[model samples]
Target: MTEQYLGLPIGPADTAFGLMAEYDADQHLNKVSLIAGAYRDENGQPWVLPSVKEAKARLAQDQNHEYLGIAGSPALINVAQSLTFGSNMTKNLDKSIASIQTVSGTGANHMAAHFLARHLRPKRVYIPSPTWINHQTIWAGVGIHIEEYPYYSAETRGVDLEGMLSVFETTAEERDVVVLQACAHNPTGVDLTHEQWARVAEVMKRKKLYVLFDSAYQGFATGDVNGDAWSIRYFVEQLIFNGEPDHPGLCVAQSFSKNFGLYGERVGVLHLVVPRHLAAQGARSELLGLARAEYSNPPRYGASIVETVLGNEELKGQWLRDLDTMSSRIKSMRRELRRRLESKETPGDWSVLESQIGMFSYTALSQKQVTRLREEFHIYLLPSGRVSICGLNEKNVEYVASAFREVIGFNSN
Candidate 1:
């Protein structure tokens, strides 16, 4: 196999399907010049939040470079639990929750998937049809069967709630894990209302299904940390009342990359909420064993930054303000994009752009239209018609909107 595969060796300098295949010879990096992810700034440069800079300064001045434990800094973990579950959360304070530091949201997700696949032996894990691109890959990599439930409706450019409920009610009984985006639904940006979340909780409770909530954007979604956490908190409350003693499986994967402006830091936490009866020493031992085999232990720097910010009251307050600023910018972009598209009377409905909330908007553009935007207009976006709202700002919003209008309208003509 090696001989045959190696014989067809293509050097790294070539492009594999569009993604750069190799680093540049001069800079030891790829030559492609495109906004890599949804990240952006007014000047098209990366913008670090002022609050994060201050926190980093404080951390750097302190001479604590010691390695954190496998479970991570207890202070950070406690703050994380509080932020997600709320300050007055009865469940969190009860000490029944067990959390471990992870590389990031993706890493936390992968860890949860592996744990479920090995320990629970669930038949399959159900994910949203239009979930994050890496969701399928991460779960499938751990030997877990991946199944999709209805999510986006192309005609309406919104969620197919009825269709989603139908799938969950029927298929949940056979699945071991059901993955949910706690706040901001990625790519589409359509979130379930509080009432809708209650309905989902009901269905999951009746089915006795285990849930894994992936919260990548937390405060970055609505600019209010508590607001974004409502769904997960509600689910936790429901699980506490309904979960059986013999079986407890409610987990949360939280990311600080977006909210804390710590993307490269790769800091996040994976929390497993169990019934008080099951909170014995043995459970923690099992979790540690799983961590030891995976990545040995999570990194220290990112976790340290998180610990510092969350631990210090002043820094925590500043972080909240920064989150508000970032969220407001994304919200403004959404409005601007919608206004531009509407003023031009671009073909098709553009209401979804306004209705959807978070860092992304589902433009409802076709694959062909998206291609035209890239080839003809030099605008980059996912083929699924999703645009990162963060990619829009004062400088480029007009150009992006015009490009979108030209491609979409021209294609319709």
Candidate 2:
């Protein structure tokens, strides 16, 4: 095709999405797809949570097809904020939080980059080396000088807490932004313990570096909302509330796509929080302006469903159970895979599979091993060897383990 635009270079297809397409085209009957981050049922199908189904049914009565204001639904913002910070802190931190409903987690992250790159004007923004694939692309689009700090150590198969703190202590400057995954870290499911978080918080407070918390999996991580949010809340108490006067404050980009199982609905919120001495009204207005320029308002239906589920007591109970159901199944898959791999004496330490939390597991499988899994066994996962634990179920866990045994070779660990 002739160039439709003057100076546009051909871009490669998105890695994850392109691979998903390849998985879709494969005709193998026993094909297992551990590619997507989405949740699947025991039957290996997309699940609509019972709570969400009920919420949709309730929405069947009162529905409106109107354009939400530039800032989107006010109700969603309130519930989202409450869910993020919990009710007490939401009230305690009264005038210090600037929150706006967003297109989704991606939209919230994008808006944050847009606002911060222009206003805070940090010399460098640091991200984890093996974070969500979109983190790099999203920040890059906003034209920020991006730096990657060490996060996961492949040799240890754990958090590189010291390395992470060293970067913040030495290289990071005041007002420099640090992106932190609140819990259930993507690709590599390793999350820092409370002590580890506290150590990092000490460095961040001393350095006066700004924080941007990306909370994509709340209750979805461990079936406990508060447990998953412990890191963020700890940072809130340590950095903003009790830190030095020069503390730059922090923001949270909360996503409802996973926890609420409303992925396509695209419901999320960005919360910009300042110290009690600072006011957030001006920041809220600025966020409104950014929202106005890009995608004006967030989707209403998803927000409404989430709001309904969270607002009603019985539905909220159902939602909690749903969270447990999803998380429990992912955990089970992890155990089953580990049990099978170890029972067969697969090479290396298979214990990491059970130890890593949430949807993904960094199997540390080599690129060549991953390729062989796809080509020979019709199994699909990221080239980085990140496997979606949700993809395995009673039906395919043994198959996946056997495939791993073949690629990795058999050895006692």
Candidate 3:
């Protein structure tokens, strides 16, 4: 008898990172990359928030390479809790919430999936159809049944509220998990309006669904951290605060990568909030156990940097301004792209460019059009038509617009 040890099928390269590799290998002089979700400045360079720079300067004198606890930095968790749920809510949620630091939003999501798969054992997990590619990958690891509910309406370039709610009402059973992007949904950039949020909350409350709110773009969405958090807060209020006792509470997977410009640092927090009458101490212990087995300890340097900026009033203010700077630039580029396309009489509705918020947009370009832009124009974007608005800048935006016009079969006179 023979035993086979190490034979495995090769897997395809990650679409985004694979394209990133191609973009990097490219030596084209006028090449433009609308690929990664990281923010880029007007000059199309990676930008570090001024607050983060200052925080690093301060930490450089006193920072150590010591390992954080398995659950990560408590100080960072404290500030992150306050950031996501606001200070008052953080205080009020004392007995009801279990929070731990994670590798990043990805780790938080992974932890939630693993924890729920073991503990809550939901029958299925529902995610937006065109969500961040990683969402599906993360859930699949936990061996849960994953389904995609309709999300963005291509016809209207908006949230498919009716379609989403119909699935929730008809198909979703109690304790089933639903992954909701807290703000500025990835790929599509479309968010539920406040009224729409309330409707979903009512259904979730009624259906007794467990929610995993992915809070990746809090301040980065519109530069107003509080405003971006409205959905999470509202859901907490509706589903947890005012709902029935049997309702399995919601959790938020918060990330510091985008808002703090600490992408490479891999800092994030996972908050599991239970009902008011229940204590989250047991769940907290389980999360800590999972964290201990997975990574041992979260990174210390990034947590210090985050805590430093968020803990101090002056640095936090500067961070807010930095958010404004990044968000405003993204908005302006959206306008510029739309203007250029419209002025050139490009095909289809370009107004979605301006209406969509945050770093990426569901561009609606077909795979063929996307390929043509890459081959002919040296422009790189996801084949699914998701483009990182951050990649557009003053120098390359017009070129990108023209590439779109050409690839979409529009040739202006």
Cα lDDT of model 2 by residue, 360-390, tens digit: 9999888888999999999999999999998
Ranking by lDDT: 3, 2, 1
TM-scores, all candidates, are: 0.90, 0.98, 0.97
Return the lDDT, model 2, position 291: 91
Error of 3 at 346 (Å): 0.4
Best by lDDT: 3
Candidate number that wins on TM-score, 1 or 2:
2
Q: Which ten residues in a row have the lowest lDDT in candidate 3?
A: 1-10
Model 3, residue pairs in steric clash: none
Backbone clash pairs for candidate 1 read 24-29
Clashes of 2: 0
Candidate 1 stretches greater than 4 Å from native: 1-38, 90-93, 242-247
For model 1, how does the per-residue alpha-carbon lDDT over 72-175 read when each residue is reduced to its tens digit? 77777888888888877834437677788887888889888877887778888889989987789888898878889888887777778898889887766643
State how far residue 215 of model 1 sits from its true place (Å): 0.8
Writing each residue's lDDT as its tens digit, candidate 3 over 1-413 gives 45445755568999999999999999999999999999999898999899999998998788477888888888998999999999998898888999999999999999999999999999999999889888999999999999999999989889999999999999999999999999999989899999999999999999999999999999999999999999999998898779899999999999989998889999999999998888999999999899989889999888999999999999999999999999999999999999999998888899999889999988889888988899989999999889999999999999999899898864322
